[model samples]
Target: MALSVLAEENILLNQQLATKEEAIRLAGQILVDNRYVEADYIEKMLEREAMTSTFMGNLVAIPHGTDDAKKDVKESGISIIQVPDGVDFGDGNIVKLIIGIAGKGGGHLDILSNIAITVSDIENVENIVAATSAKSILSFFERVN
Candidate 1:
């Protein structure tokens, strides 16, 4: 069962987003457009944001649907969008990478672990942020896999 997290199809490189909400919305759309989640999952993600900040540090933000959105996930999927200038996620946190996540069953845990391991190293996150093309970013996951 492929979790399909962070694939080339779900990546948007060098994106310029004006606001955190827009960034979150665009990231959720990537998953929806790819059929990884239901259309309403975007709203769920926004709802989750209201509860707590998904800021995981290392210039990264892992935004996922709220508990209510669990039923909205059609398949497990993730989308990684890079903001070159970064987006302020409030409290002075600028997120260079916004990772939108959706999961079916418990598969999302695998995605979380993979992302945690990949970005645990600051330099690895930097490399991902510096990737010029989506292919390169996909390769980064391959190398990790």
Candidate 2:
């Protein structure tokens, strides 16, 4: 089975987004491009963002759709975009990594859990941001996450 977190095609490194919305939009695009979810999934994510910021501590944000968005998912998948420069996530929060997820059959919880645990360590997040290549980041996830 394909791993839901940071799949080879889903991981984007050293990207820059002008705003949280652009980052979220790009994340949704990654999901759709990978055939993990439908295009409408982007709308669902935007709506969810309007309700609350997904920004987690350690400069991470896990943007996901509301429960209703589940139906739009064709497969459980995740996208990781590294913006080392960081984007403002409101309330003076700037997120360096944006993890956008589209989960089917409740598999997203596992994906999210792994990320939450991994990023809980400040050094881990820093190392990931500084990773020179996508392979290195994936290797790190395989080893520690």
Candidate 3:
């Protein structure tokens, strides 16, 4: 399966955000504006983030949610955003890469795991962060697969 089924290359972009809140807001807005999810969905994800930091370290934040708003997706989707200045994810470290995942009805674990593996690779992660366009990031998946 292609990640493109869930994420659109056009939706991914480089962000110049100054704070963690702004990064999350921008990511959430991307989903809403593209009809990938409802507006409240972002808030709920942020609430989840408050309960526990989603910062997995190495300047990465994976914010995810399993809700009714995402039940119709058919497959999970991931949107990648690069914040140039980095944002504070309440983890004492700045976050430069934001990965947002929204599952379908259920059974999105596989997709999530795959993404985790991909990003966990130092080389792969570096390539993605250094990518100049969404096309470059999308191509990384091809090599991984």
Candidate 4:
């Protein structure tokens, strides 16, 4: 599933993130509210992130998990959040985008790999951040795929 497909217009927005913890919590709530994952799933993912940095280089962060909370999802989903103020990811860099994913069916590697490809392309990330509408982001993914 395409990331933008699961990203609803209301879910995608510009936020003023003051801290990394807050960002993760807010994003996690969005996931649960959307029925993408369980309520506690985001907290667990944060614990996992604490073990290792999700901040991939260039102002991007992909927080993901492949646990039971996401075991029933038929398709992957992505929530794009832009923090104008940026959040510290314990790496001295402020995060501009938070791409959260819940991989169902135990295909965590495949989901992460796909995201890696997308985020690796600086141009694509740039396009996504530049997008003002969810449909525009979806269209961007279409072009990339």
Measured by lDDT, the strongest candidate is 1
RMSD of 3: 2.5
Residue-pair clash count for candidate 3: 0
For residue 138, model 4's alpha carbon misses the true position, in angstroms, by 1.3
Task: Write out the backbone clash pairs for model 1.
Answer: none
List where candidate 4 sits over 4 angstroms from the true fold.
1-5, 66-75
Backbone clashes in each candidate structure, one number apiece?
0, 0, 0, 0
- Tens digit of per-residue lDDT, candidate 1, span 28-137: 99999999888999998999888899889999999999987989999899999999899999899999999899988988888998888887787888898999999888
Q: How far in Å is the alpha carbon of 108 misplaced in model 1?
A: 0.5
What are the models' TM-scores? Answer: 0.95, 0.95, 0.84, 0.82
The order by descending lDDT is 1, 2, 3, 4
How high is the CA lDDT of each candidate model?
Answer: 0.88, 0.87, 0.69, 0.69
CA displacement after TM-score superposition, residue 69 of candidate 3 (Å)? 6.2
> Per-residue lDDT for 68-119 in model 3, tens only?
4465343456667977567888747788788877766554576677677887
Give model 3's TM-score versus the native structure: 0.84
Cα lDDT of model 2 by residue, 62-95, tens digit: 9999889988999888888999899999998999
